[model samples]
Target: RNDHMLSDWFRKNQEVRIYLGYAPEPNWWSVADLVHVFTGKIDGISPSFRNSMTCKIIGRDYSAPLIDTSFTVAYAARTSSQIAKMLAGKYGLKLNITDTSEIIERDMYQNRKEWEVLQALADLEGFICHVDKDKTFHFGPRQESDEEVEAELYYRSRLKSNCQVDFEDTAIDVYNQITVRHYRKKQVIEGSAKNDALIEQIGQVKERVIYNSKAKTNAQAKEMAQKLLPEFSRYVVTGKAMNMAGNPNLFCEKKVAVKGCGRFDGNYYVERFEHTLNSSGFITNLDLTNLRPDTAQQYRQDLYTKDSAILGSGNKLGSGTI
Candidate 1:
């Protein structure tokens, strides 16, 4: 009573409407459309086409619909045949008999051109030339032997008439020319700057010496100050001027005098003046830090000699009295 057999048949063979149109005011309708009108559009119909009937219900012609389906099928079959032939030819299977003549003619032309190029290349010596995609020639290696120089020359002359040199060689020549020009320009600019700097340095040294005098002192102090001033000036020229200007802490300072002689403590030459004062029979003490270390030692030894001479003179004078 459930009709399982009927439901199984409907599930296996589903029915679909293949609509076809009739020509001359082309119009058509499916079987289901007529059936739906007759059955009140309520119950389902069986999926079997065995009891199906084709009814030419007389509203419009259906020839246009038939012609359209036929044309579509024919076009699809022709396209598939063309695709199959293309695939066979690509795989070298010769699917179409008519394509052989054209393929052989193309191969023959290619082989003949390649053979001519090989012969030309084999005949060259002293200079070998090749043609590029842009139809320009390049010359480098020689293919023929040295003994075949005449043949090589003949081939070279023929190639020269047929091909022009490549743009690459022209570009290389231009690049080399530009590089040489750039190098010469750089050398000229650097040389001029160096000359200008030398002149400026000479002028600065002259001005510095003219404006400043050597520190006034006896021979030893003068020698010490002279050695120290240049190094100090270089520091001032390159360093902060306000800090090193008159800052005596950055340099050595000294004052020296005999007890009886008036103070000879100017800015410099204290040690030499003290030695002279002590030799003249006055006791003296001199600060020696104004001099460099080696110069200070030498000055101290001179002062001691002066003191010993004075004491010796005083002892001799006292002995004369006794």
Candidate 2:
């Protein structure tokens, strides 16, 4: 049904390259104006419904070498970082791996996808692993320090002019406690960590257990457990934010902040994000995980005062604010 060689514009397996740039803000230009954001192949094309006959094109990056390619036999590396490097080399992909030098007694892939093996390695070392734009692969411990955050987003309902979030989920992942066990030689070491703030907010117990970890000592086990805490309890506070500011500086495995939203204000890790720009407008959609659920604060009414009641369940005048 294609006319004027519409289907010819996108051939099967044809390489598709996309470059994105923020429209200059009032005659502002910079050296890094446009970026080569995507490199992939044309997957499909659909009919253009409008008078202009805009073709609906779809494509995906060759980001599946790790996720789809699998091999048999066991290959061992002294360090998980080394294993990641070996995979990156074998796959001819770029790497940004970090802090995976922990020693594992017995760990090797047995006929599994490269990505699954990477995921298992990450879980063992309390890290994160993924592929991003430009077919760049990443493997690293979760970002927790504020100094590493790339963006700070703000949204206040009162300030309708400054809109950043379209949909926000204050509470979702409920695992508040984690227990990790490490088997090293004949000695069996175990440690546990808790999300005190989440427990305070939900007033319940949600537990998780991790086995065959990279923890060596009891302290290391506890520390690893702590490092792995937010992945469960604070990782998924907000679902997706439609960037109102048209910012395209977002990336996965990085940290972003949402503020001025009570009980939901905290730093979030970008699990997944994408930027869509066209003739109509530009939008950067973000799938974030809450990193600092503890930052959520509460205000209570004074019990002694006649103005407000004490802390109690809702439907009562003496209840507290959440």
Candidate 3:
């Protein structure tokens, strides 16, 4: 099954690296976004604590440049999913767009890249895009669950090293009034959805500029601003958690609770995560943010309900009574 998915393009373009582990089995291969280009030992040194294998892993998104193909798009009224499909189709990539946005009279020039255009559309609609393990491209919000804390990490106990949190209040990140100008349209659209909240917190007016978009109406521009306001509200708390034990389920876009510290003890969303395993031990590092979940998605709750029903039912093993 896996061999069938590896086409001639992938075999020729994708990088391959061999890692010799303590096993009698043959080499294990996986198609990740990035792979190891080189792996071996240091110069004039045998395998020891300081002389581990030196592996260079490159990012898997080498195909990003391929998606940078330029083309013109003159859209009168088009949904974001349709535009995304057109972009993904250019590179023979599959898209899993769970949400959509709308645009009117959008025009794309030859200079702009398809990835950049896709990112712009995603930003306008509060969505994200990334390729998955199965090479399926996903476009949607970061999925969340009802669980208050996805995992727990202690500072001096679970963590091998120290953890630090930093606070930022840059004016460029937060704004009250945002004026957007279309590339071709003559009208200027202003969005002040949370003006009162901004004044109450910062006690002053902060203006931001968002110009040269493809929006064709005041409504579309306002919608873009409305979505951008919450994202740019600059009261961000970010931190680095180092040397935690390995957890397979921990990754970006998940929430975790941090304690054992006076000032930085709170719930944080994982912005980045990396886990590595070797002969020594497993290490997990995390980059977390203060963005909390607004509400749990319905699908997540449905999964819990199904789990409870299955566990509570007292039927035999294979009675087909799930």
Candidate 4:
């Protein structure tokens, strides 16, 4: 393509590294200031021989294969961190995870994708999983977003001109109560969590019930539901906060607060974001909550991947609420 030797040299399984860098203020830029943002492999390449010759290339982050490409494995009452390490090591990726005491019940993926199993485990424990540019896999409880940092951003909105809301969306899945029912050795066990304050404010209980949970005990089931209560509370205010006023630090998995925006004033999880810099200056775009379809797909697969029996006796297994 481009008649450049390197551009046409792409082949299967070749490593790729990408870095993002900028000058630090008035100081001259150096390689030390660069941040490694992506590491991947050339999973595919296609050269077109048309009138205007061109080429197409596609790849994924390095940890993708490590997480998504494995097969048959089993775990019985294994701890969360233990399983994470095992999976990472299997693929030769470095593991960076917070240890968890949560023990997962017996499970067999039956040759399913490794990510499906990990995602199922994550949902059951109300945790999260991700990887870094160095192929370092991470798993554990989701980190709490800094409210003070988010406050600083909203405060700067009045001064910055480009910071304006571009789009917003709200999900109807917001609920005050989450009920989880699972089959425990063929007996139905149930656990539920309630947000009394939310129910009171809404004037009624908006409930979401999930069947075939992976939780092994009543407490585990309840804890899974409890973790979702606060997340759903924030859904009422989910929406993209137009252009943020200042160059504020923002990233996925972080929480941002929008204020002085009427009913939209509330904390929201920054699910996705984009940053652009040019002669026009820097711009920040954000996607909050379920505005993006990937979040919806993730929820569907993560919550329902585990094998479970039907809600009642003498019935067949089927997909349940996620």
The numbered model that scores best in TM-score is 2
Per-residue accuracy of model 3 over 1-322 as CA lDDT, tens digit each? 1233222223323533332222333375443423322222112212222343333323334335434476465555566677777767665556688645444346542346776666565544445555543446665665655345778866654544344434332243355665554533334554444567876778887765554234567777778767766754645455667776666566555778878766667787665566666666656677665644222221111112222222232121111100
The TM-score of predicted model 2 comes to 0.67
Better of 1 and 3 by TM-score: 3
> Considering summed lDDT, which 10 consecutive residues are worst modelled in model 3?
313-322
User: Whole-model Cα lDDT per candidate?
Assistant: 0.21, 0.59, 0.50, 0.56
Q: Give the local distance difference test score of model 4.
A: 0.56
lDDT accuracy of residue 207 in candidate 2:
80
Backbone clashes in model 1, listed as residue pairs = 22-61, 22-62
Candidate 1 Cα RMSD (Å)? 52.8
What are the clash counts of all predictions, listed in order?
Answer: 2, 2, 2, 6
**Candidate rank order under TM-score:** 2, 4, 3, 1
Candidate 4: pairs in clash: 163-243, 163-244, 164-242, 164-243, 165-242, 166-242
lDDT of 2 at 187: 77
Candidate 1 on 79-193: residue-level lDDT in tens? Answer: 2223223322332332322111101112212223332222222221112222222222233332233112110101124233211111100111000000000112113111100
Residue pairs with colliding backbones in model 2 are 235-289, 309-318
lDDT digits (tens) for residues 182-297 of candidate 4: 65545767789998987887788888665433577888779877875676554433345445432335555455656555555556555455555445655566655422212322
Clashes by residue pair, model 3 = 33-60, 34-60
